[model samples]
Target: MHKNAFAIHGDIVWSKNPKELQTVEGGYLIVVDGISKGVYPQIPAEYQGITVVDRTGMLVIPGMSDIHVHAPQYGFRGLGMDLELLDWLNTHTFPEESKYANPEYAWRAYQIFSDDLLHSATTRAVVFGTMHVDATMTLMGKLETTGLKTMVGKVNMDRNSPDYLCEKDAATALEDTKKWLDEVEDSHFENTKPILTPRFTPTCSDELMEGLGKLRAERDLPLQSHLSENLSEIDWVKGLCPWSTCYGQTYEHFGQLAGDQPVIMAHCNWCPDNEVEILKENNVFVAHCPQSNAQLSSGIAPIRHYMDLGMNVGIGTDVAGGATLSMFRAMADAVAVSKLRWRLVDQNLAALSTEEAFYLATVGGGKVFGKVGSFDEGYEVDALVLDDSQIKTPLELTLAERLERYVYLAEEGGRIVEKYVAGRRVL
Candidate 1:
């Protein structure tokens, strides 16, 4: 028998494309040595006797991926919703992140975050850590034990931040970042990797961005940061980069937009046509964070417009800016906010359907990690077995309908009865 091979029998669902969802009820999803062999109506003859973990009457789907989230801000998820982006960062986020400098506090906070993530439906995440190198490393160590593929970034901010939380200068910030990257390189972490993070244009000086861009290219590391999240933030960026045409141009000028590695920019709520073109030209990943947008009054992102333009897109919980770490809630919020945008802001742009939301939560977000978040052949096997018996319904519903209900109604860390990452059961 193949050591890591197994078969799961249940209602298998996955996105064949953004507009199509493939569903196979009463089927077998085969995993051979951590790679999916595709879903079959019956066990193939070659693997007839392989171990079949029966999950009949339940939902078997690809595990979700959170392409953007802040690990240090998880402790204050529901606070500061009343404030806008800039004020909230000063009032709640900065003060909270400053606490991460203490190794013990960081370990405790990251432990809670990691434990919740392990039980949740996410198997992959792109996370943001604070500027403190030791504490960021601690966050990485805690998440490494979850068996989930994660890209953790140590944030760089040399200006426009609280004195307690800000780095001394561009050189100091780059040196500390290099030290963090070196630690990540020397660590024995199997599932955790480092990404370059510049907090944003207002906080990251030109010199710091230039240095980070150079480090990103030299290390061939992926990058993540915020962009055009709020109107005030966009205005601030325009003032900071007076020579740049748009907020996205600030990053583009620094060679931080795209290259050999992926770049994920969160909350492009106010990116204009030119900025959108820049993002598309570079094939940048846009992480649409609806709940965060709503909480901070940051305005709704034109997710449907981005999808229509064939832009790379994904969903993120965004932690403290949002209220919860549940990607399901994020997906639902995406669908809800799109409706409002279509009705009130732009009639030409249509609302996102639950199906499209699911696509963003799965295949779209998985694109960041490459060939992930699908049950297609040759893809890595990351599955979530959900027990929906408690979500009682009197009438029969299609598997898709059941999944839609779960997206909106299922409780995080509770309904996911079994979790698998690369065909290995971690929960």
Candidate 2:
């Protein structure tokens, strides 16, 4: 056992429930052996021997998880922002994604991705890598050193993609994925793992989808893909898999959807009844990329409805599509989109609140991967210590209110003073 026990003393803030928030003004977290043991108002006499770090007035919150992001496209964020989904994919996305064939390009691109993510207050992420296996492998290596809990995906696309970007065939794609997995088997990614990433229905043939699904079951790895993101994309899915019920069913028909394996589908901005039921039935997690949806002109997702149905969901930065890696901004955008969605879609489901958004960014989707996401007792000690020493907020503001305000408007400099993963400070 390690003798280096640790504790964080600060003004702690975190969720108490899905709908409620909590704060302890003079709270401290006891991180025993890299896992949280308990939170307290003062150090207990029995545990006085452990080392403690004092933050005085800084806010300590659970580290965030980004459920969907593209590692290769991190550099292209905010460019080509005016185009909608299909046009955007052909113009900016495919062109940029094709450059990964050169391992040198991968290093340059992924270095920006890894470094930005390292400092962005996101301690856990589900990331998409470009289709080139070698380039994707390079990304996995860089991510391992960042100390974030990540699922790095090697993207698959066999049809209707650019000549330079698409895979040669199903067999080659699967083999490439296998090779990447094999190489990483000994790399000790720590908390990072490889996932199956099919680039949506139109890009994958039936054969490739089925092969990946089987591999998922055999290895128990998670699946990440786009779902109902845009009108044209959904139409393309219907045309390709006409026998299926809806966009989600295309994956379901080929044994690709879910059984015991984990599936995270991004941008469910337009899922229908059967699709939502399929998600609920199989326990699939929805990765809500609000800024991406807004930027790509994909309609607002019915997030309030999903929460009403008790579906698990989380916020994602979505990088080039969404624009920023700051989970703080993503949380604010999530609430903004949900309020817009509530006005247009359905008013019955509660509009998104700050508590719900922050909770989703932390513990909600982290539950999909296990033992990650929160400072809850027995949870991993992945957390962020904010340096708000210079902020001039009115002293009357509650810590939770101050946190909510920070999420809406704080720049990267003020909020993330130091980042921690499993009780060890990384930055």
Candidate 3:
């Protein structure tokens, strides 16, 4: 065995596909230099001398991924749940995000959010920061210290935003974004990097979007933003850009949906067929924020349809809008909302199963980062050691049943005993 090789023995469970989950009862998962070596029934002879951490009774699963979350909104999570999408943003989101301009407030708030994220089941995330460059950098620095891999974006909004939060103009927005990216490039971050965020079509003028697209091409950075999330928002976009055929087309026309770049668009709840084709053509990833959609009265996304059409999909908390940071909550919400959609919205579609929901929370979402959220060989070893002993059950339960129970019932506390990012124990 290599000197750095180590193993953890537990009840291992992970998704093999949306329909199948691979389970190993009392198996040994080997790790060598932060890469998964594979799972074995027992420690192999070649690895016999290596260190083995015996987590006999715990359930070991791949770490969850949150593809869409707003780090600035973490401070106000669980509030303003009664409002609709546009109203909620005007009332809650923009106001709270505006506060990030204050360096001290940003540091304190981001530190708290980062600490919670480090302790939570999420090992990887794509997070949104506010328009303030220093504050966004502060959030990045705090998250970097937690040993989690993340992509943080400094938001760009030059129009249709509160005066306090909006940038002066497109040139100023691009200049600030360039400065932020240059700083990130020079810092040599190991697990964290920069993403380009144009708040959305409504807030981002065509000029600003065009400039951001150029910046993305120059830096070869990923992009993230909202999509057709609500009816009112869609109408507003149409009013703002009358010449565009659809909201997705507005992005494509501006080069924001460049074919060579990776983009994650949140709340694709109301995407039309043509827009769906555009998403598919560009191979764009959808961040399905189920709980946030429900909370904000946004319609349920056709996740089943997306799957049937072979579109890339992932789950996200979308905090404040989602009311919780738990990807387990996101999974349960995905399954529950899909049931509603299947029964009432579209009888032709099938409801999401526990296995599928689990897949979205792990493997499906992990694809955005590549080769994560699974125990396959040559994959990074981001995992969680979960102890569900607190849940009382009269009969002995299978590992799958236990996982389902944890997904639906685990509350806000320390159910996660340990968290690992790339084979390094971070918690």
For all predicted structures, in order, the TM-scores are: 0.98, 0.97, 0.98
Instruction: For candidate 2, give the lDDT of residue 163.
Output: 89
lDDT of 2 by residue, 332-355 (tens): 999998888778777876678999
Off by over 4 Å in 3: 259-261, 412-414
lDDT of 1 by residue, 377-413 (tens): 9999889998888887797988898888899888732
Q: How well does candidate 2 score on lDDT at residue 143? A: 89
Worst 10-residue lDDT window, candidate 2:
387-396
Worst 10 residues of 3 by lDDT: 409-418
Overlapping backbone residue pairs in candidate 1 total 0
In candidate 1, the residue pairs with backbone N, CA or C atoms under 3 Å apart (3 or more residues apart, or in different chains) clash, namely: none
Query: What do the candidate models score in CA lDDT, each in turn?
Result: 0.92, 0.86, 0.91
Q: What ordering of candidates by lDDT runs from best to worst? A: 1, 3, 2
Better of 1 and 2 by TM-score: 1
Shift of residue 261 alpha carbon in model 2, Å: 3.8
Candidate 1 lDDT trough over 10 residues, lowest sum = 408-417
